[model samples]
Target: MNAIEIINLTKYYGKNRGIIDVSLQVKEKSIFGFIGPNGSGKSTTIRTILNLIHPSSGEAYIFGKNCEKEYNEILKDVGYLPSEVFYYSNMKVIDLLKYSASFYKKNCDDRINYLSKIMNLDLTKKIEDLSFGNKKKVGIVQALLHSPKLLILDEPTSGLDPLIQQNFFNLLKEENKKGMTIFFSSHVLSEVQKICDEVAIIKEGRIIKIEKINNINNNNYKRIKIEVNYKIDDTFFNNIEVTNLIKEKNIYTFMYKGEINSLITKLSKIDIINIWIDEPSLEEIFMHYYDEKM
Candidate 1:
């Protein structure tokens, strides 16, 4: 059974588009990544699913229960971390955690302690004293304390340092191994690429692509620069599948998209001394998609 199902789920805020005809299903025990830029309705969709906000139309289900009707029951087995962290400033870290843990019937001290150590959160500090990163860590601990079956985290690593971000990923992976379903929402391409098994890219409140991460064409075009001992004919540019070609003296730089075998064969015929090929990063790939949509 899918852990979550959103069928034609849509929301509108006074005629302004929140999301339109959005439909998605997250499989049980899988890490699903929801990706989009700002004002793309990601948070709106998440809130609707959690029943924190009412949807104007369509339906959402968690564990086969209607989201709106069964919100209380569904929430009992779900943990959520919002995009923003808010708590009483005067409360100590331990006090805040205890208050959050009180919502669940299960004892959460051991889980809280374990997470504190794993995340390196200082329980003695007051909420107001913690840095942004530390405050996010506290939010993480509270979300996991009850050992919820499903975790919904929105921009979970926003303020975390690199080390803590890595640790958080490890924690999610470990939880998934124990049959937990993780729904991770983020705008960061690298974060989604590294941790998500499947990802859905949303733009302007619409899903543009939803596919297995392995299926994405991450092998984008490469930029190649070549320098030869002798000046090669400009005719080389004519035969080569090159874009944005630049030539000066004996040096040439261009972008190539197809198989490298043919390009390599052509290069071998020339007295090439220096060469460089720039591979695209995740950010570039994401931008490529974004540009295509525009």
Candidate 2:
């Protein structure tokens, strides 16, 4: 079953467009990545699905229930951490956590303590006195304490340090193993590539593409950098399917999308000094989509 399903989901703020005909499905117990540049409708689509904002037209479903009409029941099994987190500044971390727990029927004390230890959050600190990163830690703890079946996170790593981010990712993976579905939205493609099973790329308020991470990695696009004993004419690569060609003294660098054998045959003719070929990263693939006129 799909954990989340959005069908022709369009949202408009008066005359301004929020998202245009966006549709996608996130499989249950999987880590799905919603990625796009800033203002590309990532958050808009997320908010619409959560029923935080009414869609101009479209339907959002969470676990087969209408996200709008059945949100109260659905929310009990959903957890969300917005792009930017805010809380009552006067309360202590533990107090705020307990208050958040009060909304749920289950005791979150053990969950709270476990998450706090993993995130290295100080429960004694006041929300007003904590740094931005610390505040983010508080948000992380609160979101996970309830042990929701579905977790929706937007720009979740904003203020976290590297170590903390690693821990958070690990935590998500652990939860996923236990059947928690995660919807991770962010502009950071590298992290998305690291954890997501599939990704939907949005641009200009539309979903331009959706593909599995493995499919994207094996898409036959290669990033190649070669150094020759002597400077070679740029025309050497003109016959091949290449983009972003760069020449610096005796080295040539570019992206190639074609049969590897053809490239090897061409490379055999060059007096090569060194060569490097690697799969294009998610960020590089993301650029390929955004670079288009659409």
Best by TM-score: 2
Residue range 12-71, candidate 1, lDDT tens digits: 999799999899999999999999899999999999999999999999999999999999
Please give, for residues 1-294, the per-residue lDDT of candidate 2 as tens digits: 899999999999999989999999999999999999999999999898888999999899999999999999999999898888899999999999999999999999999999999999999999999999999999989889999999999999999999999999999999999999999999999999999999999988999999999988886578999998787876877888888788888788888888899899988998898999999888987887777544
- The true-versus-predicted C-alpha distance at residue 249 of model 2, in Å, is 2.0
Evaluate model 2: give its TM-score.
Answer: 0.96
User: lDDT (0-100) at residue 160 of candidate 1?
Assistant: 95
Query: How many residue pairs clash in model 2?
Result: 0
TM-score, one value per model? 0.85, 0.96
